[model samples]
Target: MRELFTDLDIFNAIGIVGVSLYIANYTALQTGFVRGQGYVYPTVCLIAASCVLASLMQDFNLSSAVIQVTWITISIIGITRMYVLGVTSRFSDQERLFIRHMANGLPEHRARALLDNGMWLTADPGTVLTHEGEPVDHLSFVASGKAKVIVADKTIATSGAGMAIGEITYLSGEPATATVEVAEKMHLIRFEADKLRAFVQRNPDIGAVLEQNMANHLRSKLVSMSETASRAPVPASADAAAA
Candidate 1:
């Protein structure tokens, strides 16, 4: 029994524990219990690498020690990057409120990353964003002001700040169904469709959040259209017959 509990056994146990931590952390990230871009995941990785390095010191394997050291370095870099982003990308009070309401449960870091793929611009009234029957090459989020959705020279709907413009066409890969024109001086964030798609491909979590947000926006638009239809006056002939 004394022979079984040697220094070698203790070192092996530490290595096993370190490997277990690495596996557990990876599983947590894959299962969405933790975020890959967050500090906790990388910090856990750093601890795991440190434990592995300690076990390597007892065994004195050059190759294994080098690998563990590299792992530790990478983990440290990841932790530092997350910390810096968290500190520097802190939103203002109004921006926080707007993001909270407009983003619909998107994390701040992810929101910042998404915004980084776009450009902010102000449009004068009567600015045509998407022309009817034309391909939508870009999408925009209205930070302030309003837009008119028109088809065949007749207004179909009014959209205001917090609304996503060109999303339907962007998602469907179709030409614009209606012309979208700025109805007031507007602040907006615009993203070229190709660039946005590339960014989303690189960061799938952001894509998921964006898809969810667009779905919610579409649902709300549908609800508003339904309400408008319900409130419309019946035709004179139809009203007379009902009476």
Candidate 2:
């Protein structure tokens, strides 16, 4: 085993596999490639293993050409898996709706701006959409499913489809006050915070849309909280009735 790994060719092959695996893993993990799907993790493992195999077998006698073929096959599989994940992921439906909804409210130029920044991807449960106290990098728009907004200890508000998130951080230019987590599989579109600021500075119309969306989101949350409060019993009133 030591000799096998010590050879320069083998080492280089291993290096190739290692770097490729890192790229693949980052792409999947950062971009929410495996949300709510069993195949994503398994596929990642398979690709990593294949890369190792390709590295180890390339120098063997009596089938060097065959080893190359296997390497190509593994790479092809990896690419295909990424495509499948993208096409069939949670974002498909929500992305369409996101485009349509934003289209109604935004002109073509603003719509293009949204994509030019960052865009939609699906995330799994337990994924931290954004962390409290982290520098705001991007603004995320929830396209589908739910996210938990942690306001205080044991106090959380769930934001669902069509809600805009991360704007508070963007507007305040401060670290997030609370963390956002994916409560379930969620599809989301995002815009780079810096790019958005620049765009907003240059184009007042785009800025207006962004501000409007933020207002709308705040209003919705307020309404939801109000309704929840209204449904709760007043302790003093209840005590008087009991007396």
Best by lDDT: 1
lDDT of 2 at 156: 53
- The sequence of per-residue lDDT tens digits that candidate 1 reaches over residues 217-242 is 87898799778768887999998999
The TM-score leader among the candidates is 1
Deviation in angstroms for 138 in model 2? Answer: 1.9
Q: Candidate 2's residue-wise lDDT over 114-211, tens digit each?
A: 55567668889998877877886888878888988776644457778877777778877888877888898988888888888897777655566667
**Deviation (Å) of 59 in candidate 2:** 88
TM-score of each: 0.78, 0.52
Instruction: State in Å the error of residue 127, model 1.
Output: 2.4
> What TM-score does model 1 achieve against the real structure?
0.78
